[model samples]
Target: MIEFWISAGLLCLIAMGFLLLPSLRRNRARAEEDRTAVNVALYEERVQALEEQHQAGVLDEPGLQTAQDEAARELLADTDGDAGRQRVRGRVVPMLAAVCVPVLGLLLYAKFGAIGAVEQARTAAEAPGTIEQITARLERAVRERPESSQGWYFLGRTLIAEGRAADAAKAFQRAAETGGRAPAVLGLWAQALYFAGDKQWSPQLDALTDEALAADPSEASTLGLLGIHAFDERRYADAIGFWEKLLAIMPAGEPSRQGIERSIAMAKAQMDQRSNAQDAPTPAKGIRLRVALADALQQQVRPNDAVFVFARAVDGPPMPLAVKRLRVADLPAEVSLSDTDAMMPELTLSAFEKVELVARISRAGDAQHGEWIGREQGAPRAEQALREVVIDALDKGASGNER
Candidate 1:
């Protein structure tokens, strides 16, 4: 910011020089004109005396001619070879303009220029470039602004990138304490804690991931962490389920897509191998439900509208345990909610003994809120018989149905 102001001051000086130079030259020219006028007045007086002597007959024609010639010689010798001068112009206008130019420029700039943005840009350009330098800067920043959530958050992210997960966890904790506990922040905090614990699963880490997913089911970091945990535990099917959801929400052409896809394929291969083994575990049966829009609310929905069917634990986090998406046209559709449809690996349908089944119709395709919704009033066993969920009511701030 200081450098920017110094450069701007220099440019202003250059501009002032342009405005004042011509005025300075004009003042010098006026002084020269005044000297010329003095010389002309002296010459005219000498010529007038010569003419008076001739008229008085004190000099004959030849004598007067010699005198006039001598006077002309003296006049020419005194004046030298200089151009005739014009009347001097007033200096007030030019001087006033020279003074006003810089002042007016400053005033206009103050009114219209993006001075704050310029300062911000300069600050950003001069920011620490290397990871170590940035980490140091962020550490200092957090210390100075202890209540700044953004500072703490970035510090945590930098620490994580610098391979200091324990320090990162503390930083993330500070960030959350400073009111930066958004889903992304929570996910990153959980990730840092998980890695700092040598990838060990703990109740605290589980709660963090669950809290993040409760806020936003599609939080990428939490989903990725869960998938990695499941895969490491040899829960290949669960890992595949988690990674598939992660893969679906990831933007196309992402640089990390290939790595995630490879992981998914590996998990699937492992699952296939385990299924072919003689000691394979039987797959757990999940709840089955038939969903259909009520006749009264049918006109309020479109064929292309999204339909979400899911189950959530009766007394657990708000995030869905298992979810399946379909279009309104697919209803009266039959869908199954199982571990394979789990939103997160650890939060599968079978993990909870009793769960509530819900169906919703959303025109905007958001699973959290919908125009019409239906659900079973009582919690049922995970392996309950196939049931029908009629989309019969308006979803007006409905509880326990949020994704």
Candidate 2:
């Protein structure tokens, strides 16, 4: 700015020289013309005095005439002495050119000069270039405007972005102290405290988050931070709950939606794993069996045929509660069906009080039906012995009643 003012002042001086120097020259010329007129007046006064002397009879007509001629010659000499001033007289055209030169220069400068661009460039040169410098500037701004909640909040956020969580927590505390009790401010303050405490979920964090959520139930930052906290503490179900709420409130076309959904999926998987682990110690349920083709039906079955061993609720849905499969060559092999082998979460062997075991030989390797089958009915037991099953007859369901 100083440089700008200095250069502007210099240009103004140059313009004044163009404008005022011409007027100064004209004033000097006017002074010279006034001096010439004074000389002519003095000569006229001398000629009048000589005529008066002749009238008083002090000189003849020739003496008076000679004196007048001498006075006229003296006036001519005086005019000739200032010949340069008369030759180069000041004119209206020169004065107009003097004024126009400065005016046109100013107009051209305004049209062509990039003053705004230059000023921006100068500002950029003095801009902060490092984290420390920016932090210092932000701190200064906050200090200068102590009542400005926005400035303090922005400074806190900037400190957090720089990974200075401890310092950021202090800044956020200051903001919370000075700022309105808005949900965003409270959420941000809680988030900073959560990180500052090494991701621990403390009572202070809970209170802050509660306040934030009480004000704005859908505050995403608080919800996200809570989810992260629960996940870090191995509370996967809690994490899923918080993240699902966050997902529900998120606007359409948000870029982080996919990432948040992925996080929720991962949390759900972790939740399932935790459930499985908790259930591992509980008593197991299901049946054990050994299946084979009867000796009498040896020639009726092929070695490459597939065998399926399964159980289903006797009076409930026909879908298998659990199942295992093998090739005919591996028949007579023992197998167990347990809740651990359930096909789906909602369906398990332990869910039923009674089930029927069915073993079948299907050349097509399908469990739905087979060319031959054998069956037994019993209560689903957790620690039962392997009961022998022999397939010796044709599947009679095709002939009459479907089993």
lDDT of model number 2: 0.80
How big is the positional error of residue 133 in model 1, measured in Å on the Cα after superposition?
Answer: 1.2
Candidate 2 per-residue C-alpha lDDT over 140-174 given as tens digits, one digit per residue, 9 for 90 to 100? 76776688787788888889889988888788777
Judged by TM-score, which candidate is best?
A: 2
Instruction: Tell me the tens digit of each residue's lDDT in model 1 across 216-329.
Output: 999999999999999999998889888999999999989999999999999998888877884767777898888888899767788899888888888788788989899988
Measured by C-alpha RMSD in angstroms, how accurate is candidate 1?
20.6
Model 1 bad stretches (over 4 Å): 1-123, 279-403
Worst window of 10 by summed lDDT in candidate 2? 394-403
Query: How far does residue 222 in candidate 2 sit from its true spot (Å)?
Result: 1.6
Instruction: Kindly provide the TM-score of model 2 when superposed on the true structure, using C-alpha atoms.
Output: 0.47
Q: Total clashes, candidate 1?
A: 0
Best by lDDT: 1
